[model samples]
Target: MNIFKYINEAWESLLSNKMRTILTMLGIIIGVASVISMLALGEGASDSITNSIESMGTNTIYVFRDSSVTNSKTLTLSDT
Candidate 1:
């Protein structure tokens, strides 16, 4: 069979079922849009997290004191 003939047949079939064609196209569009939106949301969240971390500075350290270890010398800003 010729490629052009097959293309013509497929096009005719799609035209015959207008509703089906529209529905199929709509489904494809929705699926692609949802995927794009999800990707954008994930990227935005990742950027926000990265920015938050970077803003805090890389050399920053968190020190949590335990009540069990009571020392006379308390943590001061100068120590950090």
Candidate 2:
């Protein structure tokens, strides 16, 4: 029931099943690596988008004309 007894039993079990231990360790390593890679990729993509938006001047404005409304006024350079 002591911690040392539990540790000894676990060690013995692992040693007795070498293949299972190796496979379990390999799975854990691969899972951790995959998670890290995905997080890094997501962060890189987010930073890229933020940098692109920031590089565009703050005064920049985008206007989209609605084709569904025939009565909408068209934007021209003189309107600025």
Question: Best candidate, lDDT-wise?
Answer: 2
Query: Best by TM-score, which number?
Result: 2
What candidate 1 gets wrong by more than 4 Å, as runs, is 63-80
**Alpha-carbon runs more than 4 Å astray in model 2:** 62-76
- Tens-digit per-residue lDDT, 1-80, candidate 1: 99999999999999999999999999999999999999999999999999999999989987777778767568787986
Pairs of colliding residues, candidate 2:
none
Structural similarity to truth (TM-score) of each candidate: 0.76, 0.77
How well is each residue in 1-80 modelled by candidate 2, as lDDT tens digits?
Answer: 89999999999999999999999999999999999999999999999999999998799987788889978787788997
* Position 59, candidate 1: lDDT: 91
